[model samples]
Target: MPPKGKQATKGQKQIQEENQSTLKFYMYIIFGINAAYLVLQYIFFYDSFTALYIILFLWAVGVNFGSYKFMSSMASKGIDLNMEAGMAEHAKDVILVTCIVQSISLISNYFWLLWLLVPGRAFYLLWVNILAPWIFAEAPEVDEKKQKKMERKMRRH
Candidate 1:
């Protein structure tokens, strides 16, 4: 058999690949929604092509591309790089922070801003990029015995 360390590393690599694929899948869905919104806006509200709308669209595209690049680079980094040990908790913090920031932006609309200061597209990108690393990080490996036990229990249910 291959060396034990090599096997563990291979498993971790596989997990990272899976995580990256999941992130990419979600990114594509987000991009599709954004594109659909832009098309619908152009069709139903031709007059809505104001400076704010243009800026928002451009910004959304930039952020989406940037986030994709960032995630790809992060995924390709050495597996032992300085990932937060407590990634699950960090993921929760990221979500909470994104929500708070978005809330502030939304509340700012009361000041009569012509368009939303923080468009949903921007927040979506932020959320994806911020959470991706943690979501993809390899979890501590379970023992084979425990795994088989769990599998047997699952099969019984």
Candidate 2:
């Protein structure tokens, strides 16, 4: 049931359910692939690159998690850090670093599965760093600088 006056149609409800199901399906697939890869890596390449791969993977996870939390906190405080293409550059740098780790992991075929974490991370950034903040944050306070910019634009038109 919707709120007292808000009407949510059946189609909208269905779509939401479908999107959630799809997300779960994708998560299952990712988990399945990584789980299989881990088993194989343990069996065959246990001595090959396990130490370095684990270290690099842990490092990547730590960096991504830390940055996401920091950015999310800033966003929740209505401190929009997304000026210009700074966030885009940050995302690209993250992917680049992940790719570097992925490349090193490519020495073993089983480890190539870890490459999926790269795009997974990009999606994480889009959701956590970008979307969640804007969707759930307080409206930013417009100072004189922004007011003047808006006024100038209005005058131009």
What's the TM-score of each model vs. the native?
0.44, 0.35
lDDT of model number 2: 0.56
RMSD of each: 16.9, 13.4
Those runs of model 1 whose alpha carbons end farther than 4 Å from true positions after fitting are 1-10, 78-157
lDDT tens per residue, model 1, 32-109: 656675676678667756786566556545655555555555567633222455333333233333333323332342
> 129-156, model 2: which lDDT tens digit per residue?
7999989999879999999999999999
The 0-to-1 C-alpha lDDT of every candidate, in the order given, reads 0.53, 0.56
Highest-scoring model, lDDT: 2
Supply the TM-score for candidate 2.
0.35
Score residue 18 of candidate 2 by CA lDDT: 49
Candidate 1: residue 77 lDDT (0-100): 63
Clashing pairs in 1: none
Candidate 2's displacement at residue 105, Å, is: 4.8
